[model samples]
Target: MEFHLVSLILAFKKDTVGIPLAEISYFWGQMGAGKTSIARLINYCLGGSIELSPALQNEFVSAKLTVRLKKGPLEIERGRDSNTVVVKWGEKEDAIQASIPARDANGELIPGTGIENLSDLLFWMSALVPPRVRKSKTKADSETKRLSMRNLLWYCYLDQDEIDSSFFYLDSRDPFSRLASLDVVRYVTGYHDEHILDLEAQLDSLRGERMAMLASIESLARVLRDVGVESEPEIHARVSRLRETADAIFREISQQRNASVSERTTVHALDGLTAQAQALNVRISGLDDAISEVLHARDRDTRHLHEIETLSIKFRRSQSARAVLAGVQFHSCPRCAQILPERPKDNCIVCGQAEIDDIPDSTEEALLQRDIKQRSEELKEIIRRHDAAIIQLRREREELDIKKRRVERERNEASARFDSAYLSSMLNKERERSALQQQADSLAAMARFPQILDSQRQKVGAIQAQEAKLRGKLKDAREAAEKDATNINTLGQLFLDCLVRSEVPGITSSDTVEIPTNSYLPEIHSPGIADNTVVSFATLSSGGKKTLFKCCFAVAMHRLATKVGAPLPGMLIIDSPMKNISERENREQFEGFYNMIYELKANELSATQFILIDKEYTAPVEELDLSLFSRHMKPNDPSKPLDPETAPLIPYYLGN
Candidate 1:
């Protein structure tokens, strides 16, 4: 399905700066849908001539595109009084304009470029184009060639009024100066000579300012701390004498306390006793459970055997006789569709005793009574034997349970004896451990005395603290000096300047860069125009600074596209390039700006596709005429039929 064949989502994708390609994709929808917004996004993606606010994010990543250009032979002056045509491989890269010879089928050059239609001309030029190279081809004049021209593929912007009325013109304050003047893909892409230099200069300025600010902060902090700290040696000597006297007194008191205390070994005996008790508990539980289970099983089996025995007596007393009922197997079943196979010789195969030839009725009661008597006798005998066996089994189970209980009782007595013996031995071991612990404690006390030499410790601590403080002060001073040059304020100002230049009128970023900061320059102003000016989205003009942002974005993208080969996958998003252009003249100027979006950088791609978002105007927006997307706008829909009301606007009748 065509992406735009259905619903028209008025919204476009958003980005901080540059016409976002994602935003423009929705541009081709019906009237009231954003079509021109898409164009602006394309322009931005290609890094066209728009100026992005410095405040807006400008990230540089690679892009790719298929080659498409106006096919034409370049006209270059040949021999004296003659001209020729030649094919040049590279697009306008470094140099926006170039002159080349126009050539025919033969090697002989032509007088002027013969092709007209740009799209078709591009194809022809592509065919004749040569490999890109830095050096220019030398003419065979025999005299060493003096003058030669070379062509370059461009990812930059150019500023020309007739070329494209840009977003820069909409601003009243003119936040961007060099930017407003910038009007080409070459200029925006940084391919222009001044771009890289400007970036470097700004970065340098920021670094310098940052350092200066840091130094100033450090100087103030250092000057504030006036404490005259004492030397480590003097403080350490006084503290050491006091600590030595305290330690001697503490040792004497601890020794006296130790001599008076005695150790207890009873806890060990208690632990051993507990373990022995737990072992016996497990044995007692298992034996008791096993005995109960055996008794229950024996009782249940015996009861069942008794009941069956009673039934056996009734079966033995009953009489028995052969019983049969007669029925014929029909070849075809009347009730169902099924057919039965032929039966054996008997008339009724189901009951052999009866015949279908003379259908037998019910069986004799006497016969059934006789058969019951015989069955009852057999049942009684079987029951008698089963009952006897069950009784024997129960007797055995009871005997086994009694034996198990006796064994468990004996085991418990043995466990109690073992517990007492283990307890005695555990007490002896505990006493030994206490004795060893006392010896180790005596040795440890002596070892700690040397380690606790108070004089040395006090001296070390004092010196370390003094050294730390001095080092801290020195570090602060050095850092302050470095920071003075590269302070946050300095960097902020530089970044702000860049942003201020990139700012589109009314498009104040939720993002802000604090600038006008400097130790020397205390009265640094805010980086941007007043907050009052940065109003609602509705207040901002579409094709103004916001739209210009896309052009600059395109220039950047073009550079990246050339680096790689083929069509670019990255999308360009433009909200509304013509958002601000409501009046006819302004709209047309923006449309021209739209054309300006597709310059050298755009030409490198397989196709510079764009999504255009357009707002339907009450009048026939003449400014929109300059844009290529104007062709895509559809006539009024079936629902919104054109009639006497909308007729004056359309050149021809489009509705009933």
Candidate 2:
């Protein structure tokens, strides 16, 4: 992608200033002349956060940025006090207003009020597919991961404070930011593309799945505690014991049935046995009714418990939202733009609704908290009731089972004693055996729960193995990418060449320059220095050397981008490159730096635009090619400084 800044327009209350950009536009002015402000305005209009001076803040109403992208030209306008931006695409007169709010209001972004965000439109217009980078090297699946044009701006722009800093290339001091900076360089150098991006996405998804499965395993452990199994190994051991118990119970039932059959010949009256059976059946039917009632009560309590839990969650959320709203202080009416009048501490600013006589701020938050507490207590009570109901249901079922067993024993005794009809007694014994067989089957089924848990554990383990494999593949891919010797050598040579051309003290073409494969940062080793002694951008003694090294490294990266056909933004803005260098003492060195930049733009890297903001040109303008510099505001023209008269001022209104 080729990105060039055409102009930056600062709209004042009464007048507007349009700053035209060129291949190398120099905004040379004294300190506090609004030179740096212009650079910051360009950044601000491009979706950056900035703190403007009071003078600029009061004078400027809005800012507009015009850039010529590969697709077409785009005009982006942003007001000082509003979050909305007006984006005009191509030559179309119809501009689309997009919101890019700093914070969400009313569940929507106030700035990006529409479906498309400023980033989306910008990336689309640039014809560049935004790639995803890891937020941290330690955690590839961090949800905070994002890579956009705004992040890329750190590489393209250098403010007055950052031009000579050791970590100027980085956006922040955090380790994650340093890694992200390296990734940005890698991306712009064509070392990363959709392939790396896809791999990262896949790794993220796999990690998510692995985490979810691990969570499920934890939940399963909690649930299985009710069945007395605490872990997978425990479940396996319990399954073995339960299977043996089930087998022993089945054998015992068979033995008892066989013993009852042998004693069937001891005679008794069939009429008496029939009367006893009828009485037993009536008792069993009553027990069945009682068990059914207990089951119904348990189901009702369970439903009530679910409802209470849901209500508790909702009440908690409502209480939190109310507390947040209660602390919000309104200074003005958003709809009417009226300044809110100061009221009593307990009175509402918008509606003038008085608070409770003895309460603070408002009673709403306290009331909501009370409601949440009440709901929490009710939920606990419902849970207690549900648990008690379950215990009662279990007791009833156990008692019913005992009664049924007793009736079966009585039936066996009666059949063995009453042998007047032998065939009928045999048939009755067969029916009793069938009922006992079903009860044994039910017990066996209950015993199989451990096996089911074991199966689930196996499934979770399989997924974990797959996740590990995917992680390995991702790691290998990253390592292979970092080991690209060709890119490292190419970038290293370009960096060294730029440093030599800039005439940086103690650096030459023959000096050992190494671009660390991991960080992609340049390191210089002088000829007479120890093998372990490596000089980096931070180790340089002179501020001018640091600034030159920073600029040269940046230019080298862009030059490499062009060579590799990477989608570089094709623009670089540097502020105060010669802040510490004296024009009288280092005039020759300054001239060399300027000439190097001119030659780079005029010959090799013509597509890339460079904006340099400094105090003044050290060399003659004609010698450096007058066409190379486009002059804007110069605060130190004839050694003049900004004073009260020249600074932006607001008019006072007279009383009527």
Candidate 3:
């Protein structure tokens, strides 16, 4: 987005140093020339950390970097050891000042911009929407984090210390930073564009909602099971059976009411009610027995499930231990203190059996875990069923007790009445019929549960279908992102070209360089004498090679970003491109590297700004741009001292 460094001003206690930047700025001198400090100060002014040398800690008062952003010239200034930076933008007359803190939680406000921190302010100035990414890779619904200025600077600046030690923080020890670094690469390459971000957000939300729905269904099924029904069909069937039994009872009661009953008939009716009451008591006792039995079974299954969980944990620990000790070869038994016999190949060291006979520990562990999972699920199902049975049995017992109470009340009323026996029998039968009708009404209410469960199932099914459709769309969109493929391909080829031009040892034109999409890191595939071998940045042998390798890839990325109009800054600040290399021994390789850089600048990157700090200078030819600024600082050569106007970065202090 065209972030060009115009100037850097370092204010000291005694004097201020103003260094003007150009299309290509080279600063090279002795070890303590303070060249690196210039780059660090520029980074510090732009909201980055600085490792202050003694000179800076003592005499350096503040540092300021003026840059030409897309909007206009911007000034960012930071005082030594300060936690905040001051940014001034707009015209020289009515420029706005923003007191930006390192963190937003510190609560400094940026004027005329609706941004909380420096990162957002930069993005706002660029007139680009800040991109959001998931904070965690493992969680689909993790909070989204916005890409910051520091992320973009990873590509723009290659510091001296990390030039050889790190590759864009891709292998950072801190997990969050590592992920952010990967996201930056993805963003630059168009893999993490706004469209993909939106689709991913939608997918995460839908997946979370769908999980909740499935959990609700499981809970609802358990509730239905407690009422002696597993499905809609089962619920309907049971309801129908209960209603039919109640209807039969009603018919018997109706017949008794219409029958002409003599004294003998009254005695028979009384005996029949007594008999019904006794039968209810017996049935209630049976229900109690069933409930108790099911409770015991449920408790037993719960204990078994607990045991399985414990064993599963122990099994996993054992597998881990085995994996850790698999490479060890013992000379003597630890317990017996006896020299061990020579073991045959493919044989167990402990058991002295063929390894083939003893199942692979990983395979065994997998099978054990699977078996434990299966058994645990089975136990859970059994316990759930037992609980349901217990609930149903208790409910039946309660209903029978109510019926027995009513029967006894009817018999007592009949005995106390002085009315005719036939009238007493008819009145008792009518009360019995009313009780049966009430029982039938209760059954009708129970039928509604099945309908409720059916509605919930429909909702879950619909959500699942929607989830499938969204997943398919996401997959298709990811596969169809042609821009990402083109950018990656271009970056890889550029990296290879840089490597070949620099004459990096052990690599030839035939050796293919690839930036794998999965890791977003470079890989070198070389055809070996016997088999193909793959090498990465970490495996590059010499420190000089590693440094050049990283710098080359960064240059290639900058070129690609410029070509595609990506949102990377237009300036590159490299501290030490030859920190470990010896120009006297490798003149051809040394000159070739700078030659490639000069060729690109003269042609494709004429507008880009380059700031390089090294111990040796590689002067650009006069045929190249005349705006090249090169500074050589020597410590005044105390043996043959000359002018006091050498203009060392901090002239008063010479400490490294």
Candidate 4:
């Protein structure tokens, strides 16, 4: 299989946007007519999953990306909610799923009319996460958190328009990127390995935060002993005195304090119902808080805006000479009708006075794009905050209402069957406990609490030792953390230095993604990067680089289709490959690229469609075009034509 018409743009070092693909197909246009825009569309259609805004910005991204061939019905992950999956193949047909899995009564994933291979890509695209929550931290408490990722592939393209490596040509012995050769001649034969000395430094930072929690428990225990609860010599008389005082208070309450006789059930019910009502009120309050937060912010902003508008209008009107005098009576010809001196300078138009107390002003398009953008963000943030609050309020309110009703019923049942004098007796008991507490306070001066006996003191000492050990551990963790931070900083610097040295690998580097790193886990560099002898088109001779770019692009498309795991649709479209270099080099490089594609097919990693924009360079290539495409044209310089009939020689089709 083959591919045709795939274009993509990669960012270049300078802030210049060009059509890396357009130059080949564009024989008659001026330099830099934004040919990379096609690259953006091609990437999008290829299922790169680029954000709409950024994808649209490709033309302005200083990357001369081209879209020469689109190869698959590439499967992609939908929005941030990773469970959902979306697949795009051409401009027709769309599908959506609540999730990739649905279980039957047997707890087995049910067979469904869902996408194929899409699940694998989706899982990988989502980094293969828990499908359901295993902890309270999960959004769904009972949700299954399982991830499966396998059989994933991705496409890669070369934007060789930005090459940095020095390579050897037949005439030039130096190498830029041998991989640039369309003919599969050892592009990247050797490999490099990045040392992991940097990764060890990162592990120390996580150990330090665990130590702080241990220190808090120790301080709490110390405070527990300071409140007259420590062990000491006992004062038995003080205890006797406290007992006597409680007895005396009990007698006094028995005679004087009489709580009205109320059934126990009724009291319980009333208290429970009251609690429920209070909870409901709390829920309502929370809702009100959320609404108020948004409202208050909106109102504050509106008021500020009004004040500004008023002030701006006044300033503008005063500054405008016509505005200041609209209210004043002025003759058509001031000098012709009256005084040599018209109205006195600085005099108000309405009255012959310089001072004007207030003036109204109007504004148009005052809220510029920036202001609108900010307000929109503010509004969205408030809405998001409010949604969480509203959910919490509803949950609390529902629970409160349910509990309140149960308590109310219990109270009513108890009230109808009164428990009589038990209520009075309970009051006497409460007074007795209070009197005992007061006497105990005085006795506490002796500091003879049994809870703080010598045995208990020993136990407390052991706790203190344990706490100290935890502290020591925590200190070690902190040291580790600091060391790790230092390593990370060093790694960051090294990474930047490497990028600078590589010179961003030409505009093509954007197509080359910086493999993602996991901060929470041990850093794992890409095998390609760790083995630094990597392949790039830059090492190719100028002619070879262009051919290598096309080849890499083809390989990338093939990879993306396979990675998506979905059956690909349509065919690859290429507009005149092998047009950027001399005929000899172009033929040699094209031949090499074909050999590689043939090898991939032999390995059963191939299924593709090809469309080429050939300029009728030679019969070997021209005949290939004729065999593939019904529409073939004779080549001529579009800039300068040979015959009058062939005035418009170049059919500017595939936006080079």
Best candidate according to TM-score: 3
Off by over 4 Å in 2: 81-95, 101-117, 139-144, 169-173, 189-193, 209-466, 618-629, 636-656
lDDT of 4 by residue, 151-201 (tens): 111113222232122122211232221212211111111010011112212
Report the candidate with higher lDDT, 1 versus 2.
2
State the lDDT at 204 in candidate 3: 65
Top lDDT: which candidate number? 3
lDDT for position 272 in model 1: 46
User: Cα deviation of 466 in candidate 3 (Å)?
Assistant: 7.3
Flag regions of model 3 displaced more than 4 Å.
92-94, 103-114, 138-143, 197-308, 319-331, 334-338, 341-472, 482-484, 526-531, 636-645, 654-656
What's the CA RMSD of model 3 in angstroms? 9.6
Residue 561 error, candidate 4, Å: 12
Question: Which is the better candidate, 2 or 3, if ranked by TM-score?
Answer: 3
| Model 1 superposed RMSD (Cα) | 35.5
* lDDT of every predicted structure (CA atoms): 0.35, 0.68, 0.78, 0.37
* Per-residue lDDT value at 311 in model 4: 61
Worst 10 residues of 4 by lDDT: 185-194
- Clash-forming residue pairs, model 3: none
Model 3 misses residue 571 by how many Å? 1.0
